[model samples]
Every structure is written in structure tokens, then in C-alpha cells.
Target chain A: MRREGSAFQGVGAVFIKELSDNISSVRMLMLELLIVLTAMAALYEAIIALRQNTAEDPFLLLRLFTVSQAPLPSFVAVLGFLIPLMAIGLGFDLINSEHNRRTLSRILAQPIYRDALLLGKYLAGLATIAISLTALWLLVIGLGLIFLGVPPGGEEIARSLAFLVIAIFYAGVWLSLAMLLSIVFRSPATAALVALGIWLFLTVLWPMLAPAFAQMISPPDPRYAALGLDTPDTAIWTQLLQRFSPNDLFGEAMLAVLSPTTRTLGPVFLDQLRGAVMGAPLPFGESVMIAWPQTVGLIACTIVLFVAGYILFQRQEVRA
Target chain B: MSDQKPEGGAASPDVVIAARDLTKRYGKTSVVDAINFDIAKGEVFGLLGPNGAGKTTTILMMLGLTEISAGRVSVLGFDPARSPLQVKRRVGYLPDAVGFYDHLTAVENLAYAAKLMGLSMAERSQRIVAALSRVRLLDVANKRVATFSRGMRQRLGLAEVIVKRAEIAILDEPTSGLDPQATLEFLDLIRELKAEGVSVLLSSHMLDQVQRVCDRVALFRTGKIVMMGSVAELAVQVLGAGFVVEVEADGAGIARRLAAIPGVGNVETLAEDRFRMTADRDVRPDAARAVVAANGALRRLSVDEPSLEAIYAHYFQASQSGGVRDAA
Candidate 1:
């Protein structure tokens, strides 16, 4: 049957309500505090480490994000690990909490379609992540200015802002995955645990497993092996397998944006590097071009996960 | 058992809700089988049955919260399945064990609902205040719902309906968990909604509670409504004018003597002496005379007004015992 009215009739209302709820929630507070503290520590270590190598490097400010001292990862690395945790924390209980509280039917009984509730929640979660990430980005840059005593180039600001946006998309991928679990499971705790477990597997284990799976799928050429050269086919296969994990896509995108000196994210033949300055930083546009595919991958994964959750939630019974 | 159409057709302006042969099936099992009913504006219509008897399923179908396997339901001249937003905009629902955001204050909770209803900010606060006051929760308007008792939460649920200014209110087991005192207060609030000309559809397993507040009720068994009508009408149909005279007296063969009364149809022995007679008319005086003539000492004599509880029991009992008269 064709349902009457716009499916998005009350989306704004749900969005505003969910946004406020996410912002004021105790879970959000704890996640924000954790991210802020770790980010500050990473920033401090990056500045101390960068002080020893103040030279003709024009991208010193960019190095503040990627440079790390022993015993602590860089700021971008810390974000790569913590962003998914924050997104999952905000979203794992989104739907099931309503079920547990017996509020799903009442809320759905309002003058809105199921589309409004799911979309509103996803947008609100993304917005919350965006706000927190932007704040942390500003804090890091402001601290870098005070500690490093150097102003970032206009291109550097643009790249980091793009990084902030991509980080939000990265957070979106995890948020949608968490929401899917929330719709699939009736218990919030179960959803949370399963989301965390998936995060651990994708971020920690998948990187290690990707190479083995790739070698099994595409063995290196014996001629290339005898020549003491890595097979391009196995290298391509590994990157393809690794891209399945959102962490890999986000990590590569962060590398391209923060470390402009990175010329290529995949295998580059000798012919492609004919006239390239080995360690020279690529232009901002070239760097974004390199990260563009990964950025799109993050967004596409988020939409796919979100649509899957929407379908499940639409079919789910309202009675608890 | 019967899907009698209301006197007027679906075009009748006064019929706020009309369902014809509405059915809900999950796989081969039908949770709600073909059923029909119409609720007039301002009528308190109750769906009464035991747990798992499809009352909640029927209610969900009415709101278009669940898909209907067959037939049609129209709420306020719109098919609930096709125009759910229109139906929902005009109808308010309070689910069994209604919940609110525990961290938000009562006013804040209602304000969210108000926004969903598209109420302007000025009107939102005004309606919220009026609604909270109507449900007697105004003093706790700013208090978080976590501190609320079950009864308080129920009243807050009602407050949400009031804030919406809905034309019809669907309540599923509204008084299930409330204490007797709070239940009475909630019923009174339902009556107040009726007095203000809002139609109500209430579903519950508690026969006595429905009997008090509902103007008409549908008695559900399994997936179908076995009987539907006013309490007095059901009593007459199921109980044969539905009068019961109880005689608590001591004597020999008093049961047989009471059964011999002219208007009495069935005589049940409560004990060696006490007898309960289902009669077409008030037979208390005749029962006492019969007991006396049987050399029974009449200690007590009274008429037990036929209630919905009795009708439900009688309908289910007769059907279960292979008695086909009432079932037919």
C-alpha cells in the first residue's frame, strides 16, 4: 500500500530531540572526556618530539598530527582507535533502548513514518561526532600554534578541515554499524558488546589477516620472487582485502591528508616515479585526490549499513 | 463471531473508526482473524480478552504499526494502513507499560511530543502545562521521569495524549500495573476525556476494569471476538436477562426446590444448602418461598446482578464444555 504523507514529515523534530539527547547524555560525556585527554597527551608528545627536528620542513604543523614518540601513538593514530569507540558508544543502544524502555511504540505512534526516526537518529549521531571532532581539531591546532611557534599554511588548514569531515564520515560508518546491531538485537548490552567485538576484529585483527588472505588468493609470480621484487598483483590484492575494514580506509585517508609527502597509497611502478622528488610533499589537491577513494569508501559503507538497519527496523514489530 | 456493520456506512461522519474483516497473520498462524467493529466519536470502546488473545495485535493494526494480512481498517475516514500518518495525527496511543525518557523532565518529555505534533513553541508549553495539570502531574512537571512511580508514569502517558489534542485515544492495558486507587483515578481521567468528546479504544484482559469505563466492549477469545455489545446487552444475550438469585439457607433438597422456580433456568448448588439460580426475571422472592416450603431455614436471600465477568465466564465456559448454544 502507498503510505500517505512524506516519510520525512517529522524528521527535524526527531533530529533536534536526538541531537540534544546525544549531547547531554552521560555516555557522550565520558567518551568526549576520554578522547580529549588522549588527544591532548598525543599532542604534547608530538610537539616535544618535533622540537628536536625543526628544520627546512615546510609541513612541520602537519607532522604534529602524524609524528609520535615511543610509548605513545600520534594524534591521528589515537583518533583512528578512539573515533569508532565513541561512535559505537553513542549508537549501540539507539533503538534497543527504546525497546527496553517500552517507548518505541509510543514514539512511532506519533505523526511520523519509521523513516523519520531512523534517519533522524543517524544524522544526530553523525552531528554529535562532527561537533566533538571539530572541537578536538581546533584544540589540537591551537595547542600546536602555542607549542610549535609556527603558523600553518592555508593548505594545511584546508587539509585538516577535510580530515575533520572525513573523520566524521569514519565515525558514521561505526555509528551505522552499531545502529544495525541495535536493531538486530533486543538487548542494548548485547548490541554494545557485539559492536565492540567487531571493532576489535576489524581494527586489530583484520590488518594482520588481510596479508595472509591476499597471498592465498593471489600468489606472487615466481619470476618476481626470484628477482627479489614484491609481486604487484599480491600487493593490489592485499590492499583490496584491507579496504573491507573501515579502519584501513580511514587510516589510509588520514595518512594521505596529514602526511602530504605520501605520493601514492598503493603500489607505484618505476615508470610512474620517473620525475618525482622522492621526499617532496605533494600539492594539497593531489593529496586529496589520493584520499578521495578512501573518503568515498567510508561514506558508502555508512550508507549501506544505515540502509540495512532501516530495513530491519521497518520490519520489526513495535510491540515489546 | 459476527461482523455486523454499523447502522450507517463508512461515510458516516460520526464513526471515528471502522474496521471490516481486519486480519493479521504471521506465517500460517493468524494472530487476529477477520473481525469488524466501528467506534463512534466520543465512545469508549473496549477490547477485552486474556493475554495472547490478539487484543494488542488488533490495536497495532488499527494504528498501522503492524501490517494487516487482509481486510481493511479506516480511522477517521482514512485507511490506517495507507494513511497511517493521518490516523496517527488524530489518534493518541498509550501502550501497556508506557515509558518516557527517564532523564528528561515531564515537561521536556511532553515538549518532544509536542514538537513531533508540530506544535508551535508558545502552544507547546501551554498545552503541556494544561495536560500535566489535567493528569494531576503539574507539580512534577519539571521533575525527571526516573523519579516517577508507575502510576505517575501512566498519568504522564495520558498527559501526552491530552497534549496532542487527539480525536481518538487508544490505550493498551492502561491500568495493568496500577494500584486500585490509581486505577480508579486513571479511569476517571478516561471518563473526563469522553466528556470532552474524544473517542477511546481501550484493550485489556481485566474485565472488571473495562466494564467500569467502556460504553461498549468486544469480548475476544483466541483470534476472534466472540461477543460485542454494551455490558447490559451482553448480560442479556449471554445470561438470559442475566439475573442471578443467591439463596443461602439450610434445608434438604433446597437445590431441587430452587430449580423448580418458574423463571429460573439453571440451579447451581454452592454447598449443601446454598444455591445460585440463573433466571430470566428477579426470582429472589420465589426462591425464598421455595426454600421455606422445602423446610429450609432461609438465612440470606439476594439477587446477584449479572456482570461482564459473569458473561465472559459463561461464554467461555459454555464453549469449553461443548455447549454450542452461546457459541452459535
Candidate 2:
């Protein structure tokens, strides 16, 4: 007799187990510490820069993410580098280690379906990333309040909150990617390295290569451009190609949400800005709209990676 | 020869597990090929085989962990492939190598299992405590599994199977890696489960242990069950109805002389004062007389039925000879 099994029958149980396991693991603790230290260091430097600035930037709270000191990078840039590491740290050994420890078969023998187990693990990882980002966000706010002495308005809080949400989404893409690598690779170390390799390629090398690739794909026409080898089409194509990298999307989304004065992610002509004030802050809705596509793109990438991993895992034979 | 299907009315076999020509093939080679057996309610069934004889493969297929290439298996009237949750819900599987989250305490590990079983918070805690105590691990319940010895881990596994209160328990190599005392204790636990009417299907290479616990056993070899019967039935089938008498005395050339006696099938010198003789009838009188005539004092004489060990050796030797004949 086939019972009508609930898809989410044991999700809560597995979710609790996964969350507790991640929370207690020394490995997770170390990764969280690394992210927090880097984020706080970046924020401290931003506060220092804000103290010396004399310009009355209407979006000063938002500038905390984009502005940096001499030795440190911006909070957004630091997170762009470290968020993937945190995700990979939590995810690289998720499945294979169960096999290594000889627990997979035993765990699967439980009444729960495999769907619950995978969903629970993924949700736990996303929750871990969410919690860390929330702490970092609150830390930045606390530092800003201490240094600037004036409480941030609702608009600043909303923008920072949006940036945090996007950061979590960006981290989820890498987390799911790392989880997929973990499923594919039997060795945990290999999984971690491969996930990191992909992250490094996207974050560090893609920006430099994207422009060149874009130029080649949509190279200038000599009939339109005499002196300028790169056309306006090339710039637009470069922006589109760069968006392929999760890091690029993450950086652009943060910039749009944190720097409300940022009117467009792509090239903007002076004619389009003729009537616009030079440094006017965009309304919260406009800022969200500006980052909307990037946020959706990051989320879509996470979902796609997770679905591939799930399909692959479902096909795999459960042997320990 | 008789599979004893439960559908045979009047017998009321109450089959908990029934497999018909079950097979598992990885590519071209079949690992568990066309094997069939039935484990009835409260019966302890043993799958005795050498390493890699496909005992684990069969168990995996039964649990729906591995896809079966051909044939069908029904557990508790449910097809594992189609209704794995229903099968898993009713069956308790103790894997060959029992493992747990080493970081968690014994209580936490059992609690996790209870949660997956969907026990309420109150029932979960009560069962965890009862299960730990049942396995005699209550004293170490709070200790991390990392600190547990191999025997303790095995006990925990047994407790897990017990706590589930399932209709059928599939224990794969349950006694492996444990000390002799622990294995004894583990077997005792299996007996207790059987007393409670839990059908057990245990796979092990240890013939003696299986002989003691299993009501029926299937001798597995090279991806197939070569012989299936109760231990007594196998003993009779292989060696025939006879008693083997060991004459504890070494009479020089006495072994051959004893073979001449009527109803005596064979004789072998056991040690410096011992000769073993096989007979189809009561031959102890003749054995004693033969030993005395050979000028050896028959210090001791003991009669025993053919053992499972002897039966296994005989079957393997017979199969090897058959193979040679077919090849020639």
C-alpha cells in the first residue's frame, strides 16, 4: 500500500538537527568569526572616513558600505570576498562527510524522505548566513550611531536592510554551489577547493576578463567609431557580461542600495542627468528598483544550483 | 524445496518479508542474483555468507536504498521501492557499521531518531531515556558518542532498533567488530526482540552465532543462495541421519579397521588417543570394540550430530567439484 507521504514530513526534525550541528561545530564558529572580524574592521575604517568628511552627503548612512580607509576596503567589497568563503565553509562537506562517517545509510533508513533532509540542510545553511549578515549589519549600525552621534532615519535603515537581504541571497548562491560541489566530489577538501576556485574566478578574474570578452563579442564598427575602439555598445555589453558573476551582481546591488545617488548601473549620458540634482538621494522604492534585477538574478542562480544538486543527489545510490 | 508462501491457507505463515527472484546488478554483473526467501513473523532468519557475497546489497534493496535490477520484494505487505516510507516506518535497520553523530551525546542521538520518527516532545524524551537504559547505556547517556567504545556503539545500535518497536528488524553484521562477550550480549538482545515477536533478518558470516539464533538460514555464495533450510534440516540433508562418535584414543591403523564395520561410513584419527567414526546407526558399541581391539584404551567417546561448520565445508567442496566437472 502506498501511503500518501507528506513532502515536508520530517523537515522540521532535520532542520533542528542541522541547525544545532552547524551552530555547535567548531568549523562554523571559526568561519563566522572570520566574517565578523573582517566586517567590523571595514566598518571601523568607514566610520573613520565619515568623521573626516566635510561634505553633507544626504546618503551618509548608505556611504558606510561603499566608503573605505587607506588600508581597508569597503564593507561591500570585503563581504563580496568573504561571504562565499563563509558559505563554502558551511557547505563543502555537507553530504560526503555523512558517507565518510558512515552515517548516511543509517540516517536515510529513518521514515523521513530524502526531500526533507536536503531541504533542511539547505535552509540551515541559508539561516546560518542570514544570522551572520544580520549581526554584521547591526554592528555597522551600532558603529555608525557611536561615531556619527545622530540616529539614522528610517530610509537609511531600510536601505541597509535591503543590502543585508541581497548579501544573504548572494551568499545563498555560493552556498548552494558549494553544496553541489560537495555532492559531486567525494572528498570534502576537494569540494571546498573547487568551490573556492570557482568563487575566486568569479570574484577576482571575471571583472578584468568580462570587459575584454564583451569587446570581442560586440566589437566596435569602424563606420561608427573612428578613434574610439570601444563603442557605447561595448560598455553596455561589458555591464551585461559582468552581471554573470555573482560577485559583480552582489557589488552592484550593494552600491545601488547603499549609494542611493547611484542613478544607473550602466553608462549614463549627461543629457539624461541635466535636470537631476548632483547628489540627491533616491527614494527607498527607487533604490530597491535599481537593485531589483540583481537581487532576482542572485536568487535565481541559487535556486538553479540547488535544483541541479537535488536532481543529481536524487539519482545517486545511497550506499555507505 | 517448499518456499512456504503465507498465502497457503491453513498454515498461517504470517510472512513479514517475502522476496521472489530478487536481484541486484551493477552493470552486467549481478551482485545478488535471483535470490528468494521468506521471513515469517517472529522468526529469526540468517543470511550467512562470506564477505562480498551480496548480503548487504540484498539488505539495501530491501530497504529501498539501492535499486533492484529485477524481481520483487515485499516487506510487511508493502513494496519498499514504491512505499519506502511505509516500509521504513515499519522496519528497523541496523547497518553493518553502526555510526552516529560523534559530537552528540547518546541521549541526543536517540532523541534525533525519535524526532525523525515523529514522536511528540514528551514521548521522544521518555523513549530516549527508556531506550538508552534498555541498551544498558543509561549511565553513559550524557557522554558524547565520540567517547563511546565500539561495543558501546553496537549496543546503542541495538537500542535504536529496539526503541523503534518495528515489526521487522534487519541487522547487517550486527556482531562484527565486537568482543565475544559483547556479541553474546547482542545476540541475547536479538533473542529478546524475537521474544517480543519482532521478525529479525540478520546477515553474518559467523555460522555458529547464526546457528544458535536463527530459526532458518540461507547459505549465500557467489551472488546466490545455494542452500536454504533450518539448521537441523541442513544437517540432515548434507550428512544424512547419522551420529558421529569420537573415540578418544589413537590406535595405530585403527581408523581404517573401523571403516570396515557395517553402517560405518568413515573414520578419522583425531589426536594421539582419539579416532572419530561416522555411522548411520547406533555404532558406539562397535566403535568401543574397535578401539579396544586396536590395543588402545577408549578413554572417552562422545556422539554428536554433524555441525553447521562441517555442513558448510561439505557444500563448498561439493560445489567446487561440481564446477570442475562442468568445466571438464
Candidate 3:
């Protein structure tokens, strides 16, 4: 009877078991629902504020819902930061905890391949993030309709969904990174620390420090520096520094979300400074393409890290 | 048990698991080196050794968890290195210090393992019940494993492995933490599997348990199998050459006189008036007559064959000396 099923069916069975086990836990369900509810409330309050104001600018509401009159940069900024933490939190102990429980070898002894174990964990983590983010997005859209007197247009909906995908992929990258660390390190606490440290370096410290470090170490060649203090060369160097960070990719993604017209940094920054910001909304597809390089880089890194982890785990002896 | 002969041979069935010149090295030190042996189908094979004697390393190589540095291993007609999934599917393993999800109930843990083994919902439920019942833990199937006692967890671990009805069960110290009663029950469960034609390769430090259950045992020391064969066979071939004679004699006075005899190797006073005489040859008759002639009345007379424990000690001593000789 066991021989009748395909390999993928076996993998799917394990994946579903892991997913159900994770979601069925009271603590995990409460934590995820709380996050979704908080994001919904925040989105609803912004939409309500926009509706009460009688502003003439057509984008006054969009800007208010996204960027302007907020506690921080934008809704995207909050999501960009919070989503990765959620991803890491969900996956940091996925593999190591199995080892700790002494069930890793027992599970591997079954017919399932090592790939199944890793893929099951990855899918479970991604599914949790997707479900939470979807719930939040739906609530926000529902609130937007209730408060703003109308539903989002086709382009607005597409742009918001695109942002959500970017957020999901960003979270997935962190999840893979955390799982890789979990396999490499023995202790769950240590794995979490390593994952959080990488997150902090990429999101907070790298953006601030990479530019300074590049300037100090290899300040644009004097020949290029002398042409102008703030030429395209300087902007190129700054962007190059920003390119080293996943957060910069997220920040660019957020900019594309809040003001659709702001696709490229040169035009976006120039328009913002000159107070000549075009009212034309950028297409969601174009915005995603602009962040495609960082997205690809992060996704590729995730694959490499996870494959290394898989190999290490396959080679590790479960003696203890 | 049905006396069906395996396809290979009756004396030594086709090797279900074979390791030849197998070696595993961690960096500079070899944990298992050139260890050669075979395990036959339906036989309860034991890998017996003291701690750090490479028993676990050999098992890990068989499971393909640890890469072999040299030599080769074939498990059930599949190369463990190349076809690990195939080999693993046919083998159930309980690692040392078996641990399961503390948050999950025993039934859930077994069901998860069964699903991993590709069992359907109905099959999983039936197998889980059967396995738990075999391990005598069906009553606590619904309770979370975190609250289980050590012995209960061990039993649950056993249930998880057998739930799939794997062809070969590899257990590493399955009864290490079990109490005497649990150990006996676990041995009975193993015996049941043997009756059902399932092969078992158990590694353990508990020599007495291994001696009782294993049809054959491989004694490992310092990364190699120094001795390997059936316990009865080994005792007969190695220690069986000598006979132990217990007789009521004049304590140390008779013991010293027996030691001086031509064929007798040594004699020690066991109790108040009894003496145990070990002879290089079968000199029990002559020694008994000698004791009777020397003002001694034989209260009890018996010629004893060497036991598994004595053979184990003998082989370990020989292996240690062999290792030292090789070093020199």
C-alpha cells in the first residue's frame, strides 16, 4: 500500500503534517493573528484619516495611506522590516529543534529523501508568512472600501499585490537563511542570534555603514571625483553601496509602492527635491523589474545557503 | 517461527548488510577503520563493544548518515552511498538517546513517521496502534510525549520505528535508559519482530541483553571488529576449548596444588569449600580424582562450558594487545 504513492505525495504528506503542526499550536496561531490584526488596524486608521480630510490633491489620500502623516516612513517600511523577523522567527529552529528532539535521524530513516525534509520546512514557513500577509492585505482592502467610499482601482490593486509578493519573497529569503543557520549551528538560540545578526547587518547597519566604508576605502577615483562633487559618478557609487543590502532593495520597493511615479532613483529623488513630482503612477511590473536584481541576488543566496545546509545535514551523524 | 531458509544460504543467509574495509575518519582520527562484517536476514545481529569503540560509527555508515572514508557497504542489495533513500526505506532506525517531539502525542509522532514512510491514512492508523500495542504503550498514545517517563519515551521510539514494518530495524542502545522490566519487555518485542521475519541489527553496551537476544554478535574495539560470530559458536570455538570444574576442595590449599598440575592452568577458591579449576585441556576427570585422593570430599562436581561474558572479556583483551602490537 505504501509503495503505490509517488514520491511527491509522500513529501506532501510530511509537508502537510509539519504545516498543520505549526499552525495548530495555540502560541503560533495567536502570534500570527495578532500580527495580522495590528497591521489591519494600522492600515484602517490611515484610510480613515484620509477619508475625513477634504484635501484637493488626488494623491493626498494615497500619500497619507502610504507615506505622509505616519509614525514612520510608510506602511511598506513597517512590513519590510517586520516580515523578515516573522520569517526568521518561524524557521530559526526548524531543523535544529528536530535534532534536539532526536527525531531527525528517525524521520530520515523513513522513505523520504533529505530534500523532502528541507522542502517541507521551507514550504511550511512560506505558507505561514503567506497566510498572515494575505489576511492583512484583505483586511486593508476591505477597510479601504469601507472608509474611502470606493474600492481600489485595477492598477492600485496590482501595485499592492506586487508589493505583497516582494514582501513574501523577502521573508522567504530570510526563512531559508534562518533554516540554513539552524542546520549549521547546534543550538537554536545561537542560530537565532546568527540569523538576527545577519538581518540587522543587512537592514540597519549595512545601508548606513556600507556607503561610509566604500567612501573611506575606495572613494571614487580622483579623476572622476574632480569632475563634480555630486556627479552621476557619486550617485553611482552610493547606489553601488546600497546594492550590497537587501534592505535597500526593500526600501526601493517601498518607494515604488508609496509613489508609483517614483520608479528610478534619479528621477524620483530629483522630482521630490524640485517639488515637480509627476502625478503619473508607475506600472507595478516596471517597479518589480527595477528591484529584480536584488531579488534575484537574495533568492540565489538563499538557494546556495540552503543547499549547503542540506549537504551538511545529510552528512551529519546522529550519534547523540 | 517458520524455518524458512533465506534465498542466500542456510548456514549464512545472503548478506542483507555487508561492510568491507569500511573506514570513517573525522579529520585526522579514524573513528571506524577497515571494519569488515555482514548481517544476514532474519538474524538478530548485535554490534557489541565498550563506549567509543566505533559501534555507532559503523551503524551511521550503514545508514549513510556518515560518509565512508574508504571501503564499501551494501544494505539489502542497495549501495548506501548511492541509494540511501532506497536503503533507508527498508530500514527503521532508533538512534541513541531517542527523542521525539515533546509537544506531539505518541500517536501523532508515529503517524508523522508513518506518513514519512509513505503510509496512507488508514494504514498509518492501523500500524500506529499495532506498534504501540506491541511496545505496550497504547494507553498513553494520546498523551503528549513531553510528559512521558524515560522508559515510556523509549517504548514510543520503538513504536515509531516498527510502525512502518520496515525490513530491517537498526537500533542503537534502544534499552540503554530502560528499567529492567522495560528492557525485558523491549526484548520480547524484538523477539516478536524476529518471529515475523524482520531482521534486527542492534548496537549496545549491555552485553547480557545482547547475549540473550542476538543470534550473532560482533565485538568491536578501537575502530575494528576484533571478533564476530554467533554467541554459541564463538563460545564453542574460542573459550569452549577449556572447561570449568567446580568441586569441594581444601580452599586455597587445594587450589595451589591444582594449579601445579600438568594440564590445569589455574584454580581459584570460589566459596568456603569449593574450587573453580580452569584447564588448558579436558582434565576435569583427572582433577576431580586428584581432589578426592588429596583428603577432599567432592560435594558438587560439574564441568562448565565458557559463557558469553568470558568470551567477550577474552576477545577485548586480545584486541587491546593486538592494537598495541600494531602500534609497536
Q: lDDT per prediction?
A: 0.90, 0.86, 0.75
Scored by lDDT, model 2 comes in at 0.86
TM-score of each: 0.91, 0.89, 0.84
Which candidate's TM-score is highest?
1
Q: In model 3, which runs have C-alpha deviations exceeding 4 angstroms?
A: A1-9, A26-34, A37-41, A56-65, A70-73, A217-231, A267-277, A318-320, B1-13, B232-243, B248-307, B314-328
What is the per-residue lDDT of model 2 for residues B1-328, given as tens digits with 9 covering 90 to 100? Answer: 1222224322235877888889999889999999988888999999998899999999989998888899988887777787788888889998988889999999888888878987889988877788788789999999999999888998898777777888999999998888899889889989989999999999998888888899999999989998998876787678774578877766576777688789887778776667777776668888778878888767787888656788898888888999999999
For model 2, name the residue pairs that clash. B248-B273, B249-B273, B249-B274, B250-B273, B250-B274
Q: Candidate 1 chain A: worst 10 consecutive residues by lDDT? A: A1-10
The Cα error of candidate 3 at residue A175, in Å, is 0.9
* TM-score computed on alpha carbons, candidate 2: 0.89
Q: Which ten residues in a row have the lowest lDDT in candidate 2 chain B?
A: B1-10
| Decreasing DockQ order of the candidates | 1, 2, 3
Give the alpha carbon lDDT tens digit for every residue of A1-320 in model 3. 12222345356866787788778877577667666665655665566567677665444434433743455345566677677778888888988888888888777777766668888878887897888888777866776677676656776776677667777877777888888888888899999999999989888888788767667655666775687554445566777787666677766765766566675654234545575445666566876676666667667766777777778876666655
DockQ, structure candidate 2 = 0.46
Q: Flag the better candidate by DockQ, 2 or 3.
A: 2
User: What DockQ, between 0 and 1, does each candidate earn?
Assistant: 0.48, 0.46, 0.44
Q: Give the lDDT of residue A149 in candidate 1.
A: 84
Specify the CAPRI tier of model 1.
Answer: acceptable
Each candidate's number of clashing pairs is: 0, 5, 1
Q: Which stretches of candidate 1 lie above 4 Å from their native place?
A: A221-228, B1-11, B245-302, B323-328
